[model samples]
Target: MGSRTQDTEECYSYHNQNQNVDYGRMAEILVRRAGSTDEFTRLTSITWINEFVKLGGEQLVPYYADILGAVLPCISDEEEKIRVVARETNEELRAIKADPAEGFDIGAILSIAKRELNSEHEATRIEALHWFFTLLDRYCAEFLAYLNDIFDPLLNALSDPSDAVSFL
Candidate 1:
């Protein structure tokens, strides 16, 4: 087991050294692993996920966006480490929403916002929804129609039982 773990670490190091590797694919696998039920796999994957997001820049924004979308649904992650990962993921999403690029996908952003609005954690959920509103206000007419379409669902969800609803 020690040798296997060392081998995995070496492979990860090798990939990190190869700057030209397909980060999107690598992130996708890590995201999948993070969702796994196995304790070791999930913890290891969360580490990779956090590392992947921390390598932020214009080139990595898309990958971070993908990671946010992939992990937002894991609101039930009990481990403190995984929760920290989720929080970091939320922060990254907010950053992306604040200054989205031409390549940014509004649909993907909305999906994550919607997921957050439904989160079990009140603070995280409310913050996510607030970020959504901030994004809407900033984008204005550009995002008006999309906001209109989602407003009803968001309102109804907010009405349902959740700590986030009280703050709404």
Candidate 2:
């Protein structure tokens, strides 16, 4: 009976170690899956942003940035499904701006503004320009300069119809 109890203890320890190993592997898999360049990942990001915005707790801001970074580059992606990711990103930015917290990064906002201005879609360009102007009004000297660098060409492009603007 004494030997059986020792054996049982060893077996339980082994089982716990195996569980830990499995959990570690599962965590890695989940991270990779979330980071995947697939439509499902993009959809999940969109859903997460929508939900996060609705909840609007302070803790989720960094998570918002993380998801945005992961999904923003896919804005110009060829896949139609992934395009929704960009739209959601724009919406998330709009939501963030509505609250106007101290933690917001002007540089990142400016980058998105430039991308929107350069978008091939006329509607997106217009929307992007609107946000650019809003940021310009709120931010200081350096941000204004950044805004000018992006906005000047866009204004020129809009004035001159010869320039092709494609959002895709």
Candidate 1 residues lying further than 4 Å off, grouped into runs, are 1-11, 96-101, 119-124
Q: Write candidate 1's Cα lDDT for 4-77 as tens digits.
A: 37635754974677676555666777776666776677777766666666564444556654676556654347
Instruction: Please give the CA lDDT of all the candidate structures.
Output: 0.63, 0.50
Ten residues in a row with the worst lDDT in model 1?
93-102
lDDT of 2 by residue, 22-92 (tens): 32222222223334566565454454444434444333443434444444545555666656655665566
Q: Candidate 2: lDDT of 92?
A: 64
Give stretches of model 2 more than 4 Å off: 1-37, 56-89, 97-101, 140-142, 145-148, 160-168
- Which candidate leads the pack in TM-score? 1
Error of 2 at 120 (Å): 2.9
